[model samples]
Structure formats: C-alpha cells, structure tokens
Target: MEKVILASRNKGKLKEIQAILEKFGMETISRDDAGIPEFEVEETGTTFEENSLLKAQAILDEAHTITIADDSGLEVDALEGAPGVYSARFAGENCTFEDNNRKLLKELEGVPEEKRGAAFVSVITMLFPDGRKLVARGECRGTILTEIHGTEGFGYDPLFLPEGENRSFAEMAPEEKNRISHRARALEKLEDMIREKCSC
Candidate 1:
C-alpha cells in the first residue's frame, strides 16, 4: 500500500483521515509515526486554503514525501466570521474546547436564532516531494445554538446545528457525522483528484 504522512498530531483527525485513505489503498501515518519531530507551524495565512498548504508544505519539507494537511474551523456569520481562521484560538492561544465554546455562546448572546448563521469549513492540501500539489475545500452550513448539546465530537460541534438537521453534529453518531462533515466532503474531493492524477 502507498504510505502517506498526515501533517497533524490530533489522533481523532488522524483516525478519520486514515479510514478514508485506507479505502483508496493508501496507508496514512502521522508525522510522529514517520519519525518527524513534533513542531508548530505558525498559521500566518488569512484563509483556510493557505493554512492547509502551509502545513502540508512544512511537513513535506521535513519528510520529503507525500503529505496531507488540513485547516478547518467554524465561521459564524453573526460574528462577521470573527472565528474564521481563528476558530481554534477564538478564546485564546491556550484555550480549551470548552473555553472556545463559552466565548462563542457569549458573543452570540441575544442574537436571534434566525440570524445566528454559520458554516463549518475544511480545506485539505496534498503535497508531494516532487512539488506537486492538490487542494480541495468543503463547507457545511448551519446555525449556532445558544447552548451546547450532545457529548460527542470536539471543537464547535456541539454548538452548531447543520442545516435541515434538528441535532448538532455532536448529537449524531460518528459515522453519520463523517458522512456529511466538511472534512469528509473535502477528502472525497481530494480522493477524486488523486485518482485522476494516478490515471493521468
């Protein structure tokens, strides 16, 4: 099987990407697994695509192999996308998931439910040692809830309800959420691009 390095240390994300890549007969491993030392890459990009490429390129520079990276976050329209690229650090650099959620709730306080529009976005970038690159983006539109719900998922999952759904992403089963998640959609597009490239 083809081996690829995923430019992330998050185990939850690694598992998700591994599962998807496995179907394409590719084995996914974290940078640590590939013997690359853990390090932080400052996300100086103003957009998801830029950040994703930054991460993938950073790892590829170190490992000189096929690497995949993604930058994803919640964009709240009510906050004028206040947390767009800063979703992870919305509360602060050292913030925890709960801290971020608390900040979001406080900011949306008194905002009518109808005006609490938001979207989860994911941008995936693949980089090869030969300098080849592929990128894909996906979004899931929804509204931000006044309170958190469900026990599953991380980040802003509990506070965002996908459109046409009564339950938050945290409320759904893992498989169910993965089916319609922004990351999943982005990976699907990435898979198509990979297949096309392989055939070329």
Candidate 2:
C-alpha cells in the first residue's frame, strides 16, 4: 500500500480523507502520526485550488514526499461566493464554526427557498517530491436550509443539503456522506488520476 501525506492539522479532515481514500486501499498519514512539526500555510490565495496547492507544496518541501492537500468551503449563490476562500474565518479571525454558521443564517433569513441555492466546493492538490503535481475539484449543489440540522459532520454541513436529499450534510452518517460529498467527488477524480498518471 502506498502511503500519502494529508497535510492538515484538523483531525476531522484527516478522518474524512482516510475514509474516502480507503476505497482504493490508500492510507493517509497526517503530521500527527508522522510526528512532523505543523506550520501555518497562509491561505493568501483567493481560490480553493490555489490554497490547496499552497499547502501541498509546503508539506512536500519539508517531507519531500507525495502529499495531498484539500481546501473547501460553502459557497452561497446570494453571497456571490462569499465564505468560499474565507470559509475558515468568515466571521472573523479565530472564529468558531457556530460563529460562521450563525452569521450565514442571519444573512439568509428572508431569502426564499429557491433563492438560497448554495453548494460545497472542494479542491485537492497533490504534490510529488519529484516535482510533479495534480489538481482536482468537485462540488455538491443544494439550497441552504433556514436553520441548522443534524449532529454529525462539521463546518457548514448542518445547513447545506445535497441535491435530491432531504437531509443536510450533517445529518448523514460519515459513510453515507463520504459516498457523495464534495470531497468524495474530488477524491474519486484524484483516484482516477493517480491510477492513470501517477500510479506507483
């Protein structure tokens, strides 16, 4: 089995990636497991793809190995893609998930159901120590609920629904969501790329 480095400090993200890649028997090792020092990868870029590349390249520089980095966020149509790149700190610096979700709901209070269309966008960038790189993106489109729902998942999962699904992302179990999430779609694309172009 080939080991890949997922350059993220968030444990939730690590678990999510692990579950998604497990389909291909790809195992991921985070900095926590590898005992590598973690550092801030400033998201100076304005797009998820750019930020994903930034993190993957930074980690590859240090580890000099194959690495995968993800950058994702909720993009509300009404907000003109707000909280896209700024998803982590939408409320402000040091913001909590609730803080961001609350502000988003407050802004969409009067919007009609149809107008609340939103989607989760994810970009994954892979960097190989040999100076090769690949990027893939995926999205799940749906409307923003008037309020939060469910008790699973993280970030904006509670309010965002996938098309044709009555429940929010947060309501779905990890296994269920992993099968259809924006991250899952992107990972599937990444897996295809790995097999076709970067197979070890």
Candidate 3:
C-alpha cells in the first residue's frame, strides 16, 4: 500500500487526515509513527501555502516519502484577521483551546450578528522526495457565534457556524463536520489530484 506521512503532531489533525486518506485506500503514518527527530519548521512565510510547503519539504527530507503538511487558521472579520496564522498561540505559547476561544469571544463581545463574519481557511500541501509537490486550499465561510456552543470539536469550532447553517461546528458530528470542514474540503481537492495523477 502507498503510505503517507502527515507532518503534524496533533492527534486530532492526524486522525482526520488519516481517515480521509484511508477512505481513498492509502496507508498513512502520523508524525510520531514516522520516527522523525525533534525539529521545528519556522512558519515565517506570509501565506498558508508558503508555510505548508516549508513543512512538507522538511518532512520529505527527513522521511524520504510522500509527506503532507497543512496550516490552518480562523480569520475573523471584525478583528481584521487578528489570529490567522497565530490561531494556535493566540493567547500565548502553550495556550489551551478554551483560552483562545475565550479571548476571541471577549474581543467580539457586543459585535452584532451581521458583523461577526468569519471563515476558516486551511492549506494542505504534499511533497515527495523527487521534487514533485501539490498544494490546495479549502475554506469554510461562517459567522462567529457570540458564545461557545457544544463540545464535539476543539479550537474555535464552538463559535463557528458554517454559512447557511444554524448549528456551530462544535455541535456537528465528526462525519458530518468532516464533510463540510475547511480541511475536509481541501483534502477532497487533494484526493482528486491524487486519484488523477498519483494512483497507480
């Protein structure tokens, strides 16, 4: 089976990516499983594509295999995208999901529903040792909820309701949300690219 190494240590992210690839009948390994040494790829790039490409290339060098990397963020309109690339450490280093979410809510307090516009952006890139690469982006446009809701998902899911839906992402079931999530959408595009070009 063809295998993929996902360049992330986040279990939740690993799980989601693994499941999607598996559905396409590809084997996958999480970062821990890939036996990579401790390393950090600086996300100094301005755009998501640049950051994801940097990470994927680093992992391909270390693993010598098809590796995929992603960088995602929550962009709030009112904040003018205050926490786009900094979503993970919005509150500070070692910040918890609740910590970031709490701060977002506070900053968004009293912001009317119409102006609470936002969207989740995800960029996924795949790199191989042979100098071949593919990149794709997915986005979920939604309004930020004033208060958190549900407990199904972590991060800003609790306060995000995808466009045309009344329920927050945190309230969505795994399969349900996966079908419409920003990452999922990006993965779907990658899936198509793989099917068209990579499948043997």
Candidate 2 segments exceeding 4 Å error: 10-27
Q: Candidate 3 lDDT, tens digit per residue, 1-200?
A: 77889899878777777776786677788877879898999998877889899899888988899899999999999999878988988999999999999999999989999999998999999887777888989999999998889999889999999998889999999888988999989988887887777753
Q: Rank the candidates by lDDT, best first.
A: 1, 3, 2
TM-score, one value per model: 0.91, 0.88, 0.87
lDDT (tens digit, per residue) of candidate 2 on 1-200: 76778898778778767775676677888966766675788889999999999999888877877788999998999999988999889999999999999999998889999899998999999888777888989999998999989989888999988999999989999888978888888877887887778656
lDDT: which candidate is best?
Answer: 1
lDDT of 1 by residue, 1-200 (tens): 88899998889878888877787788999899899987899999999999999999999888888899999999999888879999999999899999999999999989999999999999999887777888989999999998999999899999989999999999999888988999888988887888787532
| Runs off by more than 4 Å, candidate 1 | 22-25
How do these models rank on TM-score, best leading?
A: 1, 2, 3
Which residue segments of model 3 deviate by more than 4 Å? Answer: 10-26
Pairwise lDDT winner, candidates 1 and 3? 1
Instruction: Give the Cα lDDT of each candidate.
Output: 0.90, 0.86, 0.88
**How many clashes in each candidate?**
0, 0, 0
Worst 10 residues of 3 by lDDT: 191-200
Compare candidates 2 and 3 on lDDT and give the better one: 3
